[model samples]
Target: MAPPELHPAVLQSVALTVRPTSGAPLALQTKVLDLEPQPDGSTTLVVAPPPGLDPREHHFDATLAWTYPLGRMECTVRTRPGRRAYGDVWLVCANAPATRLQERAYFRARLTVPVLLTWTEATEETEETEETEEQPEPVELHGVVVDLSEGGLLATVPSRPPALGTRVEATVRVDGENLTQPATVVRHVAFASGGHGVAVAFAEPRRHGDRLRAVVFAVERRRRSRT
Candidate 1:
């Protein structure tokens, strides 16, 4: 159902998808029982246990989404044990606008900046007697940074991309200064547009986290000043 201009108080109910901590995906239909907007910018959500659901299994995470006049709003909720009602179900009071993507420990900024990637390849030894692997020369890859966070970055690569679990060193220039760090390829996807999307997580986020956070803050402030 399409609701009017999105607001915390006006949100009555929402479609909820629950994912158990055991990594089992919920395949049943579910909905918020009674959505009550609470004070202090949080909403109280009540959920009833569906068929074959254990009442004691309230410690799980869920994602809820609903459409509004402006657009669709989605948020991740951490379920907790609520009052002993409705067969001892779970309830949550959260801010609807505080989505999972926006609630990161570190802020992220979208950008179209050039990034340099370097990694080494391991070559198998030709001799059957020698079981040791040879270390090949380091190779360089180029990509455009699409999103930047203190912990990781998402880039679009034009050529063959590295496999997941590959570790690489990356460098990005921000505001005339360069930030370099070691990162691992945690995720990768090939788009129909003929480019690959690579997600790299910093091996030591604390190393260059200050610089990354400063850059993000500066970008945010500059944009806010313009608006």
Candidate 2:
């Protein structure tokens, strides 16, 4: 039986991992270029080939894996066996169902590191008429990172963590280097060990790519050493 057509929005945002049935994997990442819906509920997709990918090998049956709003999806795309276009190549594929999306794509390394968290309360400010009063300092909480990831992290705090969705600044020491960034509390759970588990997502994702990559490399190195 034929599968349902994937949503156009999902097709636009998802990145595809294209693997031909008979060939080596492409080097560069491939993203969706365009999607053309058909009256019969089928859709034609234009996928961008990675740089260094040979244009002559465009024709063949290949498996495409991508993540959409719903979850991860896989489908088979077949290109005509002939000369294909130079820029974006067109392929016909069957729509498939998506599974549950994972919370983290990158490997989460288990480690312990001290961290300082700070945030200000909205109701803490006071009105001053005669003399200008200085704003109260942000409340600081000490915590320890339980696991780390490029996107976010899970930590443990001695006290109850800040309410979910609360934005806070974290100064964490990674490999003797102090890295500070703003993050939002996504999950808070009290553990049996008397500490609270807090999950935070980085607010400014663009600025910490280098630090995250370094941490990932360090974690992988450490894992290799143990193995």
Candidate 3:
């Protein structure tokens, strides 16, 4: 079936393994189809996956990049009826600043480290590759977020330490595919072990504020997958 058209604010991208069992075409680049902002700071981005997906695979993952100016803050965005995205983060700063949206989207590409992210779904344990961690890692942290700010996070990572000044990147993984980015670790301290914590940083913060917001959004996503 032909993919339906989306609004202007929505964006889409696709990545498939070469040598796929189904022998479908190689991966193709994705583009944003439509976009629109919500009154409550959430976004309405409509996206569609690539064509010719494997019938058996039944699973496809895509990366979404939403960039709004400084004044226009947004934190949440939903794509369709089946998928609802939460965790709205905004980079709070004065003036929009001179920057390009493409450059800002770069922050979404920092998941090279390979992390093993685990979350609970339907009372059953689910796991996804957060990064490329070769060795087994243990760190089950979960909690509700108090607020979402620009380039910083306030959450409850019971066993996570505040990775202050240590770069914290975002790694989006699904069924084993991974994409990552290098974020400047700004804050990673414990509010109270087994209670709540805070980790604040940016993806490539040296460049400017453009990336600061990216981390904000990425972390918000991490929070959602947990809940």
Candidate 4:
């Protein structure tokens, strides 16, 4: 079956692997410029080809992988001779359909990092007047992140986990940088190891998403290199 049409708004980043007929594969990170299929059943993928790509090597087997809201997906396509669409952009035609890969949208890395989680509990207002807004008592919890991802994180806390759907502010140290973001608690589980595991989904900020994905991808690349 043909894959669903990808709206430009949902396209964030793509990982491309190009394999020449007689050379080793080369991996690149790129973004999708367009993906409209022609009447002849061939799909043309307009992408921003990364640096170090040989303009001469156009006919090759390439695999494009990307993540969406539902899950991750990938497809292999045979490239025809590609042409430069504009400055630093290229249009490559694909003669095949995309294969949807059933996996989580974001790549999760098993990382143990210190994180500070804070939330507020609503308290009764001392003043009965409607103009007075009820003050919430702020609560803080210190936890160690068991795993990290672009979407959310799994953290182990010593005390009782926050209730589901609770909004929280988290400050986590990643790659020597402190990232503060708001998240919603999605799950809570009691661990046999004597702590509660809380799963929270991040309210992804555009700028912070890129930085967090960079850290996750860097760690993944390092792990791949060592294997």
Ranking by lDDT: 4, 1, 2, 3
Q: Estimate each model's TM-score.
A: 0.53, 0.49, 0.24, 0.50
Candidate 2 versus the native: TM-score?
A: 0.49
Write model 2 residue lDDT over 110-159, tens digit each, in one string.
Answer: 56788888997545244332346677668888988866666677777878
Task: Give stretches of model 3 more than 4 Å off.
Answer: 1-144, 171-181, 188-194, 205-227
| lDDT comparison, 1 vs 2, better candidate | 1
lDDT of 2: 0.61
Runs with alpha carbons beyond 4 Å of true place in candidate 2: 1-103, 124-133
How many collisions between residues are there in candidate 4? 0
- Model 4 per-residue lDDT tens digits across residues 98-197: 5545477677665678999999754355334264665556899999886677888878788997788989998889878899999998766443233467
Best by the TM-score measure: 1
Candidate 4 residue spans exceeding 4 A from truth: 1-102, 123-134, 205-207
Q: Whole-model lDDT for model 3 versus the true structure?
A: 0.34
Candidate 3 — number of clashing residue pairs? 28
Better of 1 and 4 by TM-score: 1
lDDT of each: 0.64, 0.61, 0.34, 0.68
